[model samples]
Target: MTFEFLLAFAMLVVASFGHLGMWIALYNRINATGLKRTTIKRIEKAIVLACGIIPLLLLLIELNQHGLVGVLAGLFGGASAWSWLTIAYSVLAGLLGIVLAPFWIMDRPHFAIARDRYQVTSAEDLNPLKETVKNRRLYLRGRSFRKMSKLPGNQIVSLQRNCKRLKFKNLPNDIEGLRIAHLSDIHLTGQLSNAFYRLATDWIAEQRPDMIILSGDILDNEQSLHQIQPVFDGLNAPLGMYFVLGNHDRRLTDPTMVCRKLCELGWVDLGKEQAMRQHQQTTLRLIGNEQPWFQRNPSPYKFEPGRTSPGNEWTIGVSHSPDQFAWGIENRCQLMLCGHTHGGQIRLPIVGPIVAPSWYGTRYASGVFEKNETLMHVSRGLSGVHPFRWGCLPEVSVLELALL
Candidate 1:
């Protein structure tokens, strides 16, 4: 082959990487935007079409010309255009943000008041208890999408249970030794069977947590709501089963219906609300913020540590997205729980998740993060819009509180 041909091939490979990065960034922005579902869907379709058609057209043009100039120009031009457009968009967005900065009000920081500061004692990884469920029925739309994307259909249906033991020092004596079983993003739909959720709930029950909190994404669609109600009804907790709606939950045919069903099943619908629970002599405040994509409430509630009666009062924040971690810090919440990123649904070693659908990127992608006197835990989530998971495994977090 000629030197010119080799150079053209090299440029094509580099251009492919550039195009992939650009599209991924754009998709992430689309998810973070507060656009209507229909609007977002249309934009997504347009992106796919543009990405596919442009590359194909360039290839066809080069093939027809059978000339080095045509091949080189087509590949290099596409790459340069992608790079320039990305730069231009970034610059424009930054300028607009600066212009709008004056209108934005900064939230005041709220510091946690602890009788004694808490420190981590032990953190150990727990293996998942694997269970396989078989179903022959084909969910045409979902199955075809998975097949086209090369996502493992079997892995999506399989259930894996994991436990996390968290110990905190200086935990209030009254509320110390509190065990919470946290689960999130159980996207029950045509892809995941009800039996899988049943098995998960059973395992969670076995842990016997003092409180059970489901961060969000309970149902993929309204049809699965009734089917999964019985399974959720079976969950037993002294403080009761509590839940906050995720983005998908709000998209149901009737969002109110899902909330009503959860209430009927004896679960506390904590969506955008706060509740206080007393166990023994201790008092704990639970705050739930749904914060759907289109309707994000910046400050759901202002928590003041000094405003509460002293002694044994602890506050915990629950939301669908870990993006609320900042809010938790500003509200003096001791702990915040969430699970919307789905741990990117696929993680890579060392580099971590390539694409986490969050405004903050992979900063709070999964696991735990500590800022000031507050702690936040983001679950990998039990299920997702897509069934397949790669390096990231599904989990049920069992956080046990302890005193130093």
Candidate 2:
């Protein structure tokens, strides 16, 4: 082929990749956010038609045409389309990051400490849990949106076990070896079964965490609560089990009933509340802040770091969304735990997480981040709205807090 034809072909290839990336980013945003079903469906249809069908038609038209005019037309059209698509994606992404600039900047400008002092001493990946009978029924017969996503069988059953030993300078000496088993986004709907959670809890029990904290999205459908109630009840933690209401949990028909069920199972409902626990001679304060997105009451409780004396107490904040990390820091919390990003549910090798729902995008999407005195750990989460997980795997975080 001539140089002109090669150039035209290369432009078409680049535009196709750009289109795919844009759609993938959009889909990730939909999965991360709790949008209405109708809205999501409409968006999906549009993406398929515009990004998929229209491009194919354009390519076919270009191929059917003849001579230098056709080649030049294809090159110019492809280049123009790619430029517009890139600009649109960048503009939207930039706007989101800009809006959350305050929270992102607040977490910066921290005291520098030795890198070795804060390290992952141990990182272990647990085995995948056996799929339960109920899980099979749900995946095969459930009418959930995930079923319609056309997820692969392996993606549905795959789970990543992340047991990390994180050491930080701000960790208190008394609770220095504290192990907190963090589980989040356990969207226990028809797609996932109680047995999946049973295996997770059993594994956690084996680790013997001092405390167990669930960040949010415990129940997807209110009806499935009965099946998994026993699994959650069976969880054993020395300092007891604490939970915060996630956006999905709030979407339930009777969100209060869900909290009541957990409370009945002996789990503390830490929604918009604070509790203190004494581990040996050390006193630790735990605060659960549920943002007002879907909450019914949306408590007016505020955390004022200046009012409370640091004293000998260590404060830990828990929220369903990592967006609360800034609030936690302002409240003088030494450590914060969160989920809800689901690690973008699909991460690329070099590009990382393309779509994280948080206002700051994927800044605090997953893993550990330390900003000054506050250290936040975001779990990949146990489950997600979509059954398919590409590079991102479902995870149960076993955090071991240590002092420098």
Candidate 3:
């Protein structure tokens, strides 16, 4: 055999052993007691055999040089490993079930609270509803505020060194005093009353922010859009109101039309590939890379961070998830704002978020993270899935970038 063949054989041998090792470990560790010992052993054997077959299959497809024929043969052979395939699928389904099961079990209905802080401000003003909807409306209003009333200020501060201050050089001396209200992931389930959004918008208006940046995941469902549209009409800012798509928003039908509806009311969609310059000086690149359902090899141009005049302009990148931290770092972003994970949705007291989906369970679960020179701010977000926020409270971040 040639040197290339020999090398390929060695790699396949190592891969085969590694795959077998994993199966052996699982067989010894897993509690397969109720099942017949012979059955368990057979399953483990099949897993090991499939693992051993993978490298050979890959080699057949990539190195055999027979092209499609070899690829087809490998794929067919891979699928033929029924025993391992069954177990593998079962494991995947179990993991998925674990992840999504929480949403169903923990769906917070309206009107399930003890505190009066979140009660319906105006019962007469509540939106008209169908018979069933009218009954559920009362329940929804009850859970609106829940434990939030007990929290200090109903606002949680995700304090980190990165949020200390953002450095901007050419932030127009005239606009140097500009303040921005940044909010994201306001998953407006039925539990959140229409009055809450109105109150939030009114409160934001009172702050008199120069600009409003709604990062994404505004409404949780189609019904929420109707309730939210009125509240959005109440929002007003000097510069503009910008928004991007979140993972949840993309899951709905006619997402583009939804974007259009918001845009018709002066809300900028800021799709996957769009940039908006501010004050004719700084550039803001908004990338709407919806999460949990990533596209394969999406064009890099989707988030082209145009070159900014150093010491003359500040470019801020906005995204829904901080999953693209490496991309931001590569492009030399001064600041990136994002929200998702909702500070792990439910956090423990001192131990922090039990499981922050992104960042691999790091305390950087929320707030700002400073790596070298780049600053990434992951907001605690504005609303909770349920009213059970133990440690991490909802928030609206006021970010002031100063020219230093």
Candidate 4:
């Protein structure tokens, strides 16, 4: 192809990518809302159809009105509503966005496995820790999900148990080596078997966490509520088990029922209001925020760092989305636990995670992000509404807190 023709083709490709991204972002915003599954699916279908049809129509119009050379000239000459200048600028913008947002991990700044203050001491992959002694039928069914996800590059069953030792700038000396098991986004839609969660919960007991915190999206449908017990039978946290709700949980027949069930199983309900608990000699102020979904009451947090001292008390914020990162900072939380983006569910090579359901896009899709004095750990989540994952695997974390 001639230089001009090749340039035109490349420009079109970039602009097309940018256009698709715009639509995807729009749908993502809507999906983040606590809308009905059927309604969201309908809107998604419409958006996908529109994205495909619009471009095809534009191409056909250009082809019919202008031949090969004519079409290329029209593309370069600002044909119809899409001006050549505008298209050129959009192409540049798309390229710039692709360079960073997801692919911005090259500096190893936020993407580092070990930050300056924290280091991951042990990372284990536990798909089959052991057989579910109590439930053979359930184990076989849940294992079937693996067979379904055997497609190329699918890491649906690759569960990572990452133990991270984090040292806050103001961590208390007494609380050193305090381990907290962080599990989130267990979207129980019955697609994943109960035996899978059973082993997961069993492993939590093995960790012997001082405190246990589940960061939400626990149940997608009420049908899976029965499995909650069978799956999480032995979740015993010495400090206490605290949890919040996510947008997906709201989709259940009764969101409060899920909270009640988990609470009945010994998990504290942090979703209702701000709570302060004493773990050892340290005071932990847990703030739970489920905004834009089941948020009718005002936040109970004082939103002041002076209210609590890190030496004696540490504030920990629990939310479903990393969009609350700023809120955690405002509340002077020393650490935050969150999981809603599901690590974009399916991360791509170079691009990383692109389709996260967060206001900040995929900025805090997963992993530890530090800002101000608050350090946040966003879990990749054990499961999601979608059945499979790519480069991003499901995660169960043990965050070890210590003094810097």
TM-score of each: 0.75, 0.74, 0.56, 0.84
Pairs that collide in candidate 3 are 110-139, 110-140, 111-139, 111-140, 111-142, 111-143, 112-142, 112-143
Which residue runs of candidate 2 sit more than 4 Å off their true CA positions? 1-73, 76-153, 296-311
C-alpha RMSD in Å of predicted model 2 compared with the true structure = 6.2
Q: What is the C-alpha lDDT profile of model 2 across 42-95, one tens digit per residue? A: 887886687667556554554555344554654555332333544354355455
- lDDT for 335 in candidate 4 is 90
Residue 274 in model 1: shift from native, Å? 0.7
Q: Name the regions of candidate 3 deviating beyond 4 angstroms.
A: 1-175, 280-288, 291-309
Ranking by TM-score: 4, 1, 2, 3
Candidate 4 achieves a global lDDT of 0.76
Candidates ranked by lDDT: 4, 2, 1, 3
lDDT of 1 by residue, 54-130 (tens): 66765564556545654455445432232344335434444544443332212101121122433434333322222
Stretches of model 4 off by over 4 angstroms after superposition: 34-39, 66-114, 127-147, 296-299, 303-310
Of the pair 2 and 3, which is ahead by lDDT?
2
Q: What lDDT score is found at residue 104 in candidate 3?
A: 23
TM for candidate 3 is: 0.56
